[model samples]
Target chain A: MSIPADLKYTKSHEWVRLEADGSVSVGISHHAQELLGDMVFVENPTVGRKLVAGEECAVVESVKAASDVYSPIAGEVVAANGDLEGAPETLNQDSYAAWMFKLKPANAADLDGLMDATAYAAHVASEAH
Target chain B: MLKQTPLNAKHHEANAKLVDFSGWEMPIHYGSQVEEHHFVRNDAGMFDVSHMLPVDIKGEGARAFLRKLVANNIDKLQTTGRALYTCMLHEGGGVVDDLIIYFMSESWFRLVVNAGCADKDLAWMEVQRDKLAPKLSITPRRDLAMIAIQGPNAAAKLWAAMPGTRELAEAMKPFHAVVVGEMFVARTGYTGEDGFEVMVPNKAAPFFWQALLEAGVKPCGLGARDTLRLEAGMNLYGQDMDEGVTPFDSGLAWTVDMSGERDFIGKDALSRLPRNRQLVGLKLLDRGVLRGHQSVFTAQGEGEITSGSFSPTLNGSIALARVPVGIKVGDTVEVDIRGKRMKAAVVKYPFVRNGKALV
Candidate 1:
């Protein structure tokens, strides 16, 4: 799958979409779901939880193993994807559309520090070795 | 380089996710691992198990040789077509590998062992054969490949795929096998369901696989195989028990026959060693997945999970753990999952059998 040129990508395989209201919608990238096949469980960050950049915030579990979903930027979670806890396979189907949580960024400048689509795609390809 | 089975091209044709399992390039799933697991429980599914090795022992002393080489007694295999599950152990009672021995005839028996331990197991068996059963012909059947058709509709699909097998296999009981032309079909399986494990010539495996697929039996892979066997309370050889643990410590005491004065390779060591840890089932009361090598805190002491996974049948996380013998069923235990202690209940396993949850 091609990386979305509009969204900012993280080295940890998360995609960040800047919303109109200054909140950021966060979800795992398509490559992440392809690596973790057949998701079974998901736990999103609770609303109102303060998250620091690089901190482990949410979790996604496949039939094989569990992985920590790290926060891409310092933020406070305003809303979480409630449907994911019961229907984790939604992430496997369309990870880009299945946002896990929405966060209000503590510092808007932090978004500039994230990787662009090209850099993130190159990073993913380099990790193949 | 990873090894490929006879059905490698077939799996690729189906667009399976090929993963490395014990150095073999095997499919983890066709599309979804969880879906394949449910297919085996509710309908028919076939698994390519050619990675496992089958050895044939043919001689006058075949039975006598096996009687001393394994932990289980073969005297119980009075019937010619009977199949016995047993553990080949080292001199110190640690398991070398667990295998199934089929009593084909008075002078012929076949043993199916694990893929990862095949080389070591064959060496051990060959050494035992040279010293004790000198005239016995021990041959590894690499010329053949194995496929296991499992689940509720497994027998029906097998019958539909192979027209002549129903007559030879209809009245066959569990733990029994029948020779049908070039195929050796056994009424046995790792999943706790009615099925057959068929051994076919390497050249015929893909055709037979296609026949079964045409008969509506879907292809399942190693990922589903692990979870299904785990839910059935079966042990994975290296994960649950190895040369470091005895059969008694790994929920396989029933396979060990101590009825008579049978001095198997590990009997003396088993008799001399102290009974310390025991295997039990654990049902997670909290959220999150249970994985192997997690620490378990009990009233007795700390133990470790041998095999753990999210059971698709149970829709809950379950595990087989080696804990202190003092811990009883209905007791509560805490599992350290990723540094967090999660509440779990101790329960008797075979968590799901015949498409039903028993825990």
Candidate 2:
């Protein structure tokens, strides 16, 4: 529910924060974590991996089911979150802070295609009904 | 349309996350399932089990009818208020349903059956009764509601909630039942913990639920129920065994009274079939949860996981799998988890009992 205005979001419930260095850090949104319940395992894309827009690059598995973490923009994975491998429940604790992986955007302009916090909030609200 | 239990409104009021389970709208969890699981393990918790159907059999021929109806021998119930866990089967030796039958008297017996298989079970019983014992009366008590109070402190808390009922319940042994006016309290539960499954009149359900809550019994959901039952190594009817699976393969051969001079519905078929597979428990040596329908590869042959879950008690993944014969304890098996073959060790089940880990 806490969709920060500075961050961009995907319809698949991932939040992308575009850093000043032009790389985008991605993690699942608070709403996504709440829906999936307690997360037990999180598999992030390896560094240097190429990803296309809407590509399934990662997986977040809870006790109930497994969910694919789709890439919001075409990019090369620069860094994967090592902390998450030890404690996957951190995503459930604070999703926005626990970024899954960092990606060097293939095209800086692709960031504009993602929805802002307000638009993403509206999207999530619409899906509820 | 899904069936709604009497506590549906109450669960909604508590902000429960509802899911459609076996054609009934039931609460899967309130907020956090893991928290609910831990609560029951350390303290007391209650479950709204009104979806489970209770049928009262009454008549002079009640005992005789049940003797012919179920796989487990009912002659063991010589004393009143004794309960027996048994599986009802079709003529083909496949399990129809697993149920708990409590003998109140020679003419009065109460049966508690799974919610999903209630209708089919009732119809099957009716057909059997018509052909076997026409004088017996089969009454489905939809007018009653059930609640399971479980955990280490569950019985004491339940006693505190309903003051006078404890003395009578305390006198009763495990797997026994005692009727206190309109409420029938059984010292039984699906969880590995010690507790009581109390059945009361439908109208008094909300009141009793509230009273138990006031007594500090946490309201647990089905999420905790699954983890607890798995830890206990109890076989879930539809998941572990069904109309297509026999007791021998489902780890319930002991429950089938084949040795006694009693002729039940599935006796002949069971006696004739060759037992090729046996159900055993698996402890995963690798990281990841073991789930149902996962293919298990053993030294003997390929097998299937019947029921699997992450054990909250052991903090590891465990499962009940039906594997080919000759796979003994301490044997290593490979499980196909999401296309990856993971190693697991086969061990004796009943993973936890009386709040202690056995395997």
Candidate 3:
């Protein structure tokens, strides 16, 4: 339910935050984590790997089911959260703060193409039915 | 609209995440499923299992009727409040459903059957009653609600929440039940942990649930229940075995009483059928989650995982699979997970019990 004003989100619930280095840190949205429930394993995309927008790049598994994490924008993965391998529940605790991977956007303008906070909130609201 | 249980409002008030289970609107979790699973394993947790149906059989022919209907010998239930877990099967030896029958008296018995299989089971039971024991009367008790309190501290929590229950249930061993007023407290649970499955009047369900909550028993949902039962090596009626399979193939041969000379519903067909595939436990040697219907490749032949999950108790993935009869404990098998063959070891099931991992 907490959709930060600064972060952009994908329809699939991935959140993108523009970091200080111009590289954007990406993770699943708070709503995504809530729906998935208590993540037990997070398979983060490898660093230095190139990804296309909307590609299934990683997996986040919960006790109930396994879900594919899609890339919000095309980019080269700069860093993967190694901490997730040992403690995946951190994502469930604070999804916005626990970034899954850092990406150097292939086209920085692609960030604007994703849904903003208002749009993402509406998208989530529409899904409830 | 999905069917709702008597405690549906109580679950919503607890902020449960509701999901469509079979035809019923049931809670999948109240919060973190892993935490709920741990609560039931370590402390105490309660589940609103009112979706299941309770049927009562009464008359002089009640005992005689069940003996011919189920695969397991019901005559073994000699003492009052003694329960028997058995599979009701078809003439072809396929499982109709698995149920728990409690011997309340010489002429009266209680049966708790799965929610999904209730209607079909009733119809099947009626058919058998008309053909065999026409004198018995079977009545479905829809006015009752069921709650399962599980874990190491489950009994203490129950005693504290409902006063005087300790006196009635303290000495009750596993598979035994005691009637305290209108509540039927059975020392039985799907989870490997010690607990009781209490049945009470539908109107009192909310009050009982609130009392348990105040007693420090956490509210768990079906998600944790499935994981706990899976780790305990319990067979789920539809997932682990169904109308397509018999008890011998579902890791439930021990529950089937074929040793007796008495004939049961599926006895004749089970005797003639060849036991080719058998259920075995799987411990993932490598990373990844094992899910139901996933293909399994043994040294002898191919098979399928009946029920699989990430076991919270063991902190690893485990599964129950039906593989070729040649596969044994300590053998290695490859599971086709998302098109990749992942290495897994075949081990004796109950991967976890009493907060300890056996494999």
Candidate 4:
């Protein structure tokens, strides 16, 4: 799957979409969910929780193992996807569509530090070999 | 640098996600592991299990050698083609390996052991054979390849692949083996499904695997195999019990024969040891997945999960935990998943069988 050119990505495989209201929607990248096959349980960051950049804020458990979903930037979680509690497979179907949480960025400049679609796509390809 | 099975090329052709399992390069999944798992439970799926070693024992001392070698009594193997599940143990009562012993003849028996423990098991067996049954021959058949076709529809699929072999396979009881041409087919599997574990010559394996695939048998992998076996309440050799743990604590005491007059390798040590912990099944009451080495908190005492997975059939996390012996079925315990303690119910296992949930 091609990386969405519009979204920013983290090295840990989390993707962040800058929203119109300055809050950012965060979810795992398509490649991340593909690597971790069959999501069984997903625990999103609780709303109102303050998360530092690179903080392990959420968890995604697949049939094989559980992995932490790190926060891509310093932020406070404003909302979380409640649908994931009962339907975790949505992430498997379309990871970008199934956003885990929305965060209000503490510093908007932090978004520029993340990899662009080209750099992220290159990183993913490099890891494959 | 990794060992390749006979079906290695076939797995690559199928675009399987190959992973380094122990020292062998084996497929972890073909596509979606969940889909592969569901295929095994609902229809049919096949796994390349050639990495596991098959040792053929022959001689007049074969039975006597095995009688003193394993915890389960070889005396129970009365008929030809019958199979017995047993644990080979160290002198300290710790499990050397868990294996399936097939009574092929009075003087000929076959033992299939875990791939990772093959060398260790053979070395241990050779020691016993040298000491007590010097005449017995233990041969590890690396020339053979094994494939497990499992699920409710497995028999029909196998028959489709190997025409006219249906009657032979269907006639054999569970845990029974039959030789059809060059293939040694056993009505046995690690998955808790009606299936066959066929051992064929390494040269013929890729062809047979392709034939089965053409017969509509989905190619499963080690990922599905783990979930299926965990649901079946089967113990994984290295994770569930190893050289440091006894069979009594691994939910294999029934396979151990204490009532008989047989004197097995670890009988003396086992008889004297007091049982403190016992293996039990756990169904997650909370959301997170249970995994190996996770701490278990029971009223009786703290314990640990030996083999745990997200059960596809049950749609929940399940585990085989070694807890205080006092814990019984229906008792609720807490499993420490990372930092949080999650509720899990202790239950009798073989959690799912024949496409149905038991617990």
Candidate 2 clashing pairs, residues 3+ apart or interchain: none
- TM per candidate comes to 0.98, 0.97, 0.98, 0.98
DockQ of 4: 0.93
Q: Can you give the lDDT of residue A95 in candidate 4?
A: 94
TM-score of 3: 0.98
Report lDDT (CA) for all predictions: 0.94, 0.92, 0.93, 0.93
- Native-to-model Cα distance after best TM-score fit, residue B279 in candidate 1, in Å: 0.3
Q: What share of the true interface contacts does each candidate keep?
A: 0.93, 0.50, 0.86, 1.00
Query: Residue A29 in model 1: shift from native, Å?
Result: 1.4
Among residues 3 or more apart in sequence or in different chains, the pairs in candidate 1 whose N, CA or C atoms overlap within 3 Å are: none
Error of 3 at B241 (Å): 0.4
Candidate 3's displacement at residue B107, Å, is: 0.5
Give candidate 4 misplaced runs (Cα > 4 Å). none
Clashing pairs in 3: none
Worst 10 residues of 2 chain B by lDDT: B308-317
Quality class of the docking in candidate 3, CAPRI style? high
Error of 4 at B294 (Å): 1.0
DockQ of 3: 0.82
Report the number of clashing residue pairs per model: 0, 0, 0, 0
Q: In angstroms, how far off is B292's CA in candidate 1?
A: 0.3
For model 2 the local lDDT of residue A13 reads: 95
Residues B1-359, candidate 2: write the lDDT tens digits: 98888898889989999999998999998987878888888899999999999999999989889999999999989998999999999999999999999999999999999999999999999999999999889999999999999989998899889997977898788899999988999999998888999999989999999999999999989988988888898999888999998999999988998986889999999999999999999999998888899999999999999988777778778999999999999999999998889999999989998778888
Kindly list the interface RMSD, in angstroms, of each predicted candidate in the order they appear: 0.7, 1.3, 0.9, 0.7
Per-residue error for B183 in candidate 4, Å, reads 0.3
Error of 1 at A107 (Å): 2.1
